[model samples]
Target: MPNSSPKFSYIDYNAQTVTIKRLRQLSRLLDTVITVPGTPIAIGLDPIIGFIPIGGDVLGLILSSYIVYEASRLGVPKKLLSRMIFNIIIDSLLGSFPIIGDLFDFAWTANHYNIKLLEKHLNGY
Candidate 1:
């Protein structure tokens, strides 16, 4: 069967096209997945923002949704998108609590997890 997982296509946010590249294209300066060649200054935002109170965590959750929405728009398969959406929902719901929420966010790498799911389905790994 044809691939049903989502693809990292282009996102027209604010009149600019944003390509969701796994490591670099979608990668930002402070992405969590920094490597040897990656700049230390650009570490992932997971740690930094998790320090914020409820408001900060809420903001993070909102920001994270953009990727999933973009994936849906790219005509990714419903099944894959559903799984990604499920992760996001759970992350947000669990992340809304007090101290435990922060802990959940730290442990739940929803973006990474969703990306892995996409890669797995795409590569048949």
Candidate 2:
């Protein structure tokens, strides 16, 4: 008789863990890792890079896409994937503008949000 229980793949789990760790590092680098000198506010490279002419926002979009790709690999459901893509789209679209977009990037933090979503999904929630 064959076992009916699902067999967990240790290799897959290890791969997923590595991916999550890298994504978390990327999110922190882009979203919130620095403190303003005279204020309590924290910021990251994403908004600062948004000050670049045209390439900055594009770069952000590309970076954000990696998370979505990883999520897909991890077998995230369609609904959650849609939400993750939406977050990236909103961040990219808003971050494409000039001054306003820079401000938006500062506040949006889409990668952080997507990471949270990924965590929720992975946790079987």
> In TM-score terms, which candidate is top?
2
lDDT of the structure predicted as candidate 2: 0.88
lDDT of each: 0.62, 0.88
Count the clashes in each prediction.
4, 0
Q: Report how far residue 35 has shifted in candidate 2, in Å.
A: 2.1
Consecutive 10-residue window with the lowest summed lDDT within model 2: 2-11
Tens digits of per-residue lDDT for model 1 on 1-125? 86675543554443222334632233242235554474443345653575677676666666666767766665568888989889878877887777887677656777777766665654557
Model 1, position 13, has a per-residue lDDT of 46
User: In candidate 2, which residue ranges exceed 4 Å CA deviation?
Assistant: 1-11, 37-40
lDDT of 2 by residue, 9-124 (tens): 33377888999999999999989889889997878888888888889888888888999988887888889999999999999898888898888888898999999999988988
Which stretches of candidate 1 lie above 4 Å from their native place? 1-18, 22-43
Instruction: Look at candidate 1 and tell me the lDDT of residue 49.
Output: 73
Q: List the residue pairs that clash in candidate 2.
A: none
- In angstroms, give how far residue 41 of model 1 lies from its true place: 16
- What does each candidate score in C-alpha RMSD? 7.8, 4.1
lDDT: which candidate is best?
Answer: 2
